[model samples]
Target: MSEGSAVHQWLCWGALYLLAARVALSSETRRPCPQSCHCNSVLQEVNCSDGQLTTVPNSLPQNTKLLNLTHNKMKTLVHWQFQSLPQLLDLDLSDNIMALIEVEAFLGLERLITLRLARNHLKIIPVGVFAGLPELKLLDISSNEILVFLDFTFRDLTALQFFKAADNDLVFISHQAFTGLTSLQELHLDGCNLTAVPTEALTQLSGLRSLHFHQLGLATLQNYSFRQLEHLKELVITSWRWLETLSGNSLFGLNLTSLTIRHCNLRAVPYIPLHHLVYLVYLDLSFNPITDIHRNLLGELLRLQELHLVGGSLLRIEIGAFKGLAHFKLLNVSRNLLTTLEVGAFHSVDTLKTLGLDNNPLACDCRLLWAVPRRLYLDFRGNPPTCTTSDQLQGRYFLDFTESELPGLLTCRQPRILNRRPREVRVDQGHTVGVYCVAEGDPLPSVTWISPQLKPLSSIGRIRALSNGSLEVRYAQPQDSGAYLCVASNAAGNDSLPVSLHVRAFPLSSEKHFRLKGWFAFPSASPGLSGKQNIPFDVKTLMVAATIGFLSFFSSVSVCFIFMFFWSKSRGQIKHTATIAYVPRSAVSSSNGGKGNYMETSRFTMKLI
Candidate 1:
């Protein structure tokens, strides 16, 4: 054997040994699985849920695609925990006690597409923790203790399509936090402490389709809050305790399909620029305090299909309130304070399929006849609308009223005396007298008078019935001094009142003359001076007899007139006053030869002194 051949054999043997050792080490590192974890080589998956592990295992399969470490005791994520697994497509570390994530913790995960670190104790995310993940498409950090989103937090995640940070302690997000998420389609920040919409952060995600901010601390939605998000399709914002106003342009520049803003303590239907949302199909503004629906409130929303305004403080729907909503299919106005709905309120909505007006106080009179014909499209399945007015229609369903029954039910109100005629009237003889009776009813009542002559008085000689149901008596006499009845009658019923008239006579003057010759001649005149008695006597004798007769007559008449005048002057009597009786026209005309005229005239006597 030569010395050179021996040296070559030894060097070759040493090289072979080193190569075998490397192979053995590599094989050993890939064989063993983490404790209490299941590894399926065929599927390239590892599940370590509820394992009580404190950290990620060091000896994971390099080709593993799905890793789940949920419900574990892992406290922190050091840099590059899965550095050896470049083919990892999905990683879930949810429900872990992870409080910190070191910078570059996911540095080597170039092919990672989905990452979930939800329900953890992480309070902050380092700026570059998710950097270099160009292929990452979905990330969920929900239900965590993250307090703020720094600028460029997701700047490098350009290909991310779905991101959820809901139910976190996030109070602030920088304008550039979501700057590079051009492909993001859905974003959720519900159950967070945000005080305003992340408008600046959302502008970068022009392709966003759905957004959720439910259970937030936001107070108002300013104008153009969602401006430039032309491709947004659906938005949900519910249960905001302080949210009050939504500016008219808050939803501008968006092509939304569905919107929900319920339980936000809003006072009215937020003034949304409906013209801009031409493609909107469903809108929910329930649980608000809106009072009325004015005409054209939902103007020209031609494509709108469903509208929800339930559980509000609505009172009225003005005429033509829902104009230009020709395609409306479902309308919910249930559980409100609506009392009246005007005619043609829903005239423009020819395609209405479901009209929910339950649990309201509707008038249910002729005014509701507009809806009775359309009852087929109404939804009274839950607590039908009840009538709030009309005595005969009260407590009845508006749909049950028929067209003919409505008119009768509407005219059932009895005649009510809005103003009554005077109970007592005083008028001087030969003066005009008038009395008015005013009343109100569904069908205006006709008024007539029962005169002092006990007749049903119409326009006759000096008496006339005015157009306004007033009684006018021209040249009232002392005979018109009794109770007059003013009767008002209508379809419902009749009402009447009694008015007493006192006709005062003309006062006598103190300078009136007294009669002397008539007082003496009344006693001197015989009962029957049948024949003419001729007195034959001389002039002197006749003169003496005449003088004696004149003396005797003058003495008796003067004494009688003096006594009567003094008696009348001392008594203060009203001899011209007279009592009048009121009787029905039927009774008066029969007794007075069908003339119904009974006028009593007073006579005045003139005496010469």
Candidate 2:
């Protein structure tokens, strides 16, 4: 027989064996049911929930495997209350308003596997209350008035695997609170009043695999926070308002495969700290104010498969941000401030099976044309990515445009000069002068200055065009006094603006102004020898000239500073040093992945206590 067939037959045989055992146990006898309670002999279960009983029923069925006393008025469990029911496997005493339990309350129920004491007024648990429940695997004492957990609080639950103590006023935990829980795997401590991660107490769970924390007052995750949790596989944190920092060494010793940090006050990604998580496969950092994903920040995690950054202020994802992630399959960046997705942002789009770009105000242009052929993988089943501010494709969806129609639907906007208003500059001979011209466009058009002589100005001599597209003239002379043009051009088109410059000669003391004006105004003209006019020096003229000169100097200095600022910033940009993995095209489509809505909120929720 084939291996698959053999396994299927084995499973069928196991099911039949379990059914036969249950039937034989049910045929033995029918036990008596206590008053105000329901009993099922076939299932060996007793349910006394919502019965308003004041105490445990002493007449419970002896062979019962499940006992539910939830929603009762029992104030306490007396010593040896369940001694007669040795076969009980599940015991629920939740919402019972039970405030106390004797040290020997669960004396003889040695086979119990699940115990719940949630939503009660219990303030403490005696040391020996759980001394005999050796087979217990799950315990819940959440939503209570418990202030602290004493030493060896759960010393007898050696087989425990899951423990929930959420929504409690837990202020302190003894170092030995979980002394005997050797088999524990998952522990939830959300909504507690603790100041930080209880590292000292968590080291006791050597076999722990998953941990969760939320709504704590921790401001930072210090270095080596979980250094000793060697076997941890997953870690989740949420709703921590004061949490803003994750130290570089915080996750040094962990080999986690999944990590989630949402609804926190983080302004940027903790790249240094995440570098050691080389085995990570899933990362979710939603609802934070992370403005940029600089290159090389996340490339170290080569095993990463999925990344989600929704509802954030993400402005840019630099080139090579996902360079080393060979197995990456999905990327969700919805509801962000991303204007365009650069083509070089990923190593190769071929490996991606699902892409989420919904709810973002995308600028439809050639930058997004690369994604047209991959529309089948864009995850457009729900709300596809739409253009909100593009000149031509606004209110249109990316999936609606085919590869051939991209040239028409996604277009480049022509460059347009911003400062088109003509302004005339008047400076004394040998003084400096600067004319400013700004423009806006797609593809970022380049600027060129045209001299009055109709010659293109270069950065060679006393005249130059600042990197910010402004023209400057040093040691101004009569030849430089004329209309200067500024032209901005890109692949789409070009725009030009004309500005006039006047270099006046110093007037003789005896020369008089033909047209005098107010102190704040410039004189219209002056008596001259032919077309060349001269003006006498005065406080008003000097002030005007000084003001004009200062403006030119300030403009040149400001534009030059802006150019250098951006130049330095670009030079300091980081690049990923990790080597990228290249898989065959056949492997790309064969890889497994999960599809999900980009704009959807987290689905993780706690059980109501």
Candidate 3:
């Protein structure tokens, strides 16, 4: 009980009391989980899914990293509802009936990386609703009734990388709506009511790599619609029924590697500015109304690896159609109206690996023989093409024919006029006139033109015979007004058509004449033409035709003889008729401990064990 001992004891007691107070304060600061929620402190997660709660739960764990309030009946996100959870990394309020989000809803969640408000009833997002989530990388406000995106709506979400606002009633988006999303890589705006490309709005996403705008109400894409998206690599635009024309340069400056535009009403493939898409690798233009695969249509796609033209109205594939696709791998031209395939149509695609030509009306003639060598790489399993031209080969699979049968079957077809020439053509003096003629034969008919004076006319000057057998006459005069003859001859036969040209004097007006010249300067003609008098048949030509006919007939007879011989030999080799006999198994088993039974038939013997 000395003075020093009393002082020491008092100091020790004071220290112990302060330590106890600190422990109590720490315990008071720790928050308890709400009654409807499930908290896992070890994993720092709080889940209140399907709780049917009308309001956001309070007293959430402060250190929670993930908070899921999905399938709740919460109507709104009030200001600072989750302010206490500053360490939150993910917040999912999806499948809720939330219709409104206050400006300061996420006021203090600066460390949040993901926020999902999908499947909610939100009609509009306030400008500062996501103001405090600076580190957010993904935001999904999809499946809502959002009608418009105002300017700077996401101005505070600079770090956002993936954003999905699909399945919304969005009809308009301000030009600066995505001004702050510099780091955005993927944006999905599918199933929106957008009628046109949001070019101005997309200009803000300079670093975006993938964009999805499918199932929209867009009608057309004007030039340079996506010119500002230089870094974009993948673009998907499918199920646009109203979309018809894609203007040249619409995708001019993009470096897209994969582009999908299917199930649209486009009559032809868009003339994409391919010079900018040097890195393009995959392209899909399926389920469109494109009628023809013209030469050089995809010439500039040198790096293209796959092309899809399935379910289209493609009637013809001209020679050199796939001209510049050096690295082309797969070509899908199935389910089209392709009746003839020209030789060397895919000559430029030396690297082609797979070709799909099923579900097409293919004329199994010599023209299709070009694919015989590459048949190993072709896929015809989905409705194999049947012969449509030759009567003997009709309804038979093209792949069933032997190499020897092809030459005779193909050469037997005679030359015929596929496109008839107009009887006459009238044009004003100083204007242009054109005549075309198209023919089809086994050897591909050779076209010749005869002048009015019964002299042969070769392609020269303004009058030239195009490769497609169309004749063009520029600056028509009185002398040019005469009958022109187009003769197409092959080894099988010859066809001649005549077209009369009449030129009328132009009016005495310099302005009108000049306008006519400008307008008719490049008058194009379809493949056809005509004249009087067939060319004199030479003995050499006749002999060659006769030889071809004889050889074809001889080959066909030889094949028939060989088939008959094999059939007769097969009949003679079959000596016995097949018959089945049965006996009781118990009787046979009694001799072998029920291990087996035996039966004898006329053609064979069998034993059951």
Q: Relative to the true structure, how large is the alpha-carbon lDDT of every model? A: 0.80, 0.84, 0.82
- How many residue pairs collide in each prediction? 2, 0, 13
Please give, for residues 447-536, the per-residue lDDT of candidate 3 as tens digits.
Answer: 888888877777787777777888888987766888888888754568889989898864444332212233344333421232212323
Worst 10 residues of 1 by lDDT: 527-536
Candidate 1 shows a clash count of 2
List candidate 2 stretches off by more than 4 Å.
1-30, 413-439, 443-609
Model 1, residue 60: C-alpha shift (Å): 3.6
Q: Is candidate 2 or candidate 3 better by lDDT?
A: 2
Which of the predicted structures, 2 or 3, would earn the higher TM-score when compared with the native? 2
**Residue pairs in collision within model 1:** 454-582, 454-583
Once superposed on the true structure, which residue ranges of model 1 sit more than 4 Å away at CA? 1-33, 39-44, 272-275, 339-343, 361-609
lDDT value for model 3: 0.82
Candidate 3: where is the Cα deviation over 4 Å? 1-45, 272-276, 377-478, 481-609
Q: Which candidate should be chosen as best, given lDDT against the real structure? A: 2
Give the winner by TM-score. Answer: 2
